[model samples]
Target: MTTAPLASNSSPASVAEMEQSLEQLKVANYYLRVALDQVTDGVVIVESEPSDPKCGPKVLFSNAAAAMLAGADPETGLRGLGLNDLVAGDKDATTLQASLQQAVQNGGCHECECALQSLRTQAPIPCKWRVRAVFNSLRKLLNFTILISPAQPNAPAKADPKPAVEDLDAQSVQLRKENLAALAQGIAHDVNNLLGPVTVRLSALIQQVQEHPALAHELQAVFAGLKRAKQFTSQVVTASKAVPRKHEPTDLSALMRDTVEFAGAGSNVHVCVRQDDNLRLALADPVKLSQVLQNLVMNGIQAMPRGGYMDVEAHNHMVGGTGDGRLKPGPHVLLVVRDRGCGIARENLGRLFRESFTTKADGNGIGLTTCKRFIDEMGGEIRVTSTPNVGTEFRVYLPAAEGSGSTKPLSPADAAPVPLKHGKGKVLIVDDEDDLRKVANMILTRCGYEVVQCDNGQDAVKIYQSLFRTGTPPDVVLMDLTLRGGMNGTETAAEILHLDPEARIVCTSGSVTQEVQMVFLERGFVGVLPKPYEAGELTQTVHRVATMMKRN
Candidate 1:
């Protein structure tokens, strides 16, 4: 009944048939690869060993098109590249990974849209991605097949093309803004590091030159310029990160000057800024206020493309009564941006601040709307007055800061510099910037503090650990969020806390996002010191943090 086990099929005919089947399989695999390479859509194969799912999926193979799409060399393909390496942001990468895992378990094709990081330019390219799970005959998971294609925007119906044009125009402008934001974020860290030392040094120089009035005045001007540069960088980061708005006493005169100068730079437009001798500080978000001013000034410049004069004026005003519904009764800082250009039509004046309402042929009409929204959020008012072919004017009224806090327009004679706070404590400074460390050391040393400096996080941890072992841990550890290599500031802080949980660490970074600061605080950091800080601020922060630690 055993059937003789198929008569032991090792004969010459059987061997020949087996060789033929093996040859056919080789031919089929070669053809499949060629077909994948010839397709327009990108094809990538991802696989993970069943025994080691924790290792996740590795890029097993990619066709020519896939290589091109992923910004890899066609000959080399994208094999062995980490999954996260293909996605642009951390959030997006996590989402894609989750989707892949779901597809593996649920047995269906999963789709998502995400920006892919291009290896050649290191730019983000938006794409539509799909993942399908592959399984063996036993239903055990084997691998995944991924298809990538460029993302296409949904268009409006063909009846009315105006909406489509407006949509495209808006998309174009948004794309440009995103690109600029990315560029700004990329350079902000380096720029802040470069400016931090100069800022601290300038503060010290001004104090040193106070004996000579004229010399101090000259130094004050340089310091003012440095502040403007820092403010610009901060505004860029604020916009890109979309941090929460903060209202504080703002020097509107300085913002006006900076915006007018920036908007008119290299342009034929003539811009003049005027401020009252006793202009009061405004209670507003300095970053958003700067943005609003920039938008208005830029609009004025564009209005007069053939070269014309624009006036930007800031003054203190008192509203005794709430006569109109537009503004509340209070002290206000009145800002005027006037342009001698082709004005809007009388009928369109009311719609100036309306969303997506544009008078220009190519305008998407979001600038004025955003300005209005931001002004309103700050308890302010914005009004527009225009006459066709005559001129146009934009008026912004911001709530004046409490008290008699009038800001003088960059007058060194009226500006009395704040003295640096003296402190006695040991501080461990971790930063990669050499000049910055030198300046920090100089400032802290003069203020009666012992300072130890290190370039990277590895050394930083080691120094702190040794200090702790010797029973003389630094009273305050100033940790920079970004380091050139090895562990970052957060990771270093974690390691230090692991060694000594009661360590008082302060997070210093160019990024001032509320979310980022909160994360650091929750991770056992006691304080935060933003970069590009003056000597006074640095000394004050260190003193306060050290004093608190001693109290604890």
Candidate 2:
């Protein structure tokens, strides 16, 4: 060792070898950095002084994922931060410190679930932290390595083993539900388009048959059937809608009476309704609540094959002491529907609200489920009690409208219906369905409007622009939302608005979802009209929008 002293300067070959080694090390370091960055788990190295454990640890290094987890710029990294800075609260920091101390003492790895706060977002994120203590050759604590991963919210500490088949089945069921919802949405649109022509043609026929009383009566009956079909289509459309219901102060007593009368019509079942004298209004979506009650009443009517009586009663209830656990403490409108019919079996009671769980031979199995869904969305609860061969009772609890009192019920004269008015103006109808376009044309023409029809959004836009340039822009534009082989209604409406900000465009769609309606309105549409609408609705909507345009 003494004879072989280090050379002050190396030869050319030796220098080249040294440079090659250095380059290889640099290459290895680059690969290591790349590998660390590729890891999904957050990796961080924190240095701590073994002599002063109370001083806590300082972050020495963090990979890209770790930096992201801390809500710091990933490219810059979170190297100069302290361990306590990343914790959510004082308690979290204390817990983390204890875990680090334990790992240091045991010279082993430790793990704990923590709620860490991101510096940028300042939001507490649940994470599973795996910490290992590092020691120097002298057995002195040096630093700690941490691996952090996002923890499943409220997951069990010890996960139980699940069969692979069970997981696959659950996934399959979820996928099937999603697919069915999408299919239902598409079918509802197509059905509404198909029904539009039928409804318009029926209206035309009814007008023609007015002179012949017998034919008029027959056509009226056919029209009633079509109305019922329209109701069914509305339910299908609502099933796929996930938006929040637009709640309003609704008269529960009036709604119950109307539903009972409508559901028990033509059936042998008789419906009786009793309303509380001082009943308060309920905060509910009138249309959805009406649908729920109608479904329940119809189910009650169907339960009784022979002649039977159904009683519907409504009252205001105060829920606080000894109240329902499912609902919060508040005043609620309680509606009870009691039917003397063949009651539900004990086994079927548990699954009455489950989708596709029906005992009827011809039942589509979605009626009760849809009803339950609507009730839930409206922040209400529905419960059923039944006794075999005796009867069944359904109780619905809806939150009462805030600040509502025992006010007098609205009279027929309170809100007079606006009579359908005939208007003289150019109207444009856009729809991919030929039948729908023809139906709209017929309705608009009958309303004394100069009707222009196009089968796609592109043609409609072109026609609108051409008319606009000629200073003969349509008074109203009815744009169908979903289109085939061209720009959709939203896109077309945007273009039309750009060309003429004063354009009065009404969005037409078979999807009667709040989200769809709101989106169109946000995109500058003046109004929204659901498909398969009556001639009166079509006339009224156009007249209303045209009037608005004139006033503006």
Going through the candidates in the order shown, the clash numbers are 0, 0
lDDT of 1 by residue, 1-552 (tens): 456554565899988888789667856765787788788888888874423343346787787677766555343468777667778888888888888888877875799888777664555767788989888998887788889876766677788768867765754554455445555664786688888998988888788887898988767766766776777677666655545557899898777765666657788988888888878899998877887998998898888879989999988988878534566788888999999999988888888889999977999999999999999999899998988787899999988988855676564443334569998999999988888988899999999999999998878888999999999999999988877645568778989999999899998888665546776788899999888888988898899888884623
The prediction achieving the highest TM-score against the true structure is 2
Q: Which stretches of candidate 1 lie over 4 Å from their true place?
A: 1-180, 247-283, 287-333, 336-395, 399-418, 514-516
lDDT of 1 at 511: 63
What lDDT, from 0 to 1, does candidate 2 have? 0.77
Q: What is the Cα-based lDDT of residue 471 in candidate 2?
A: 88
TM-scores of the models, in the order given: 0.58, 0.59
Candidate 2, which segments miss by more than 4 Å at Cα?
1-174, 198-241, 325-327, 344-379, 406-418, 494-503, 521-524, 547-552
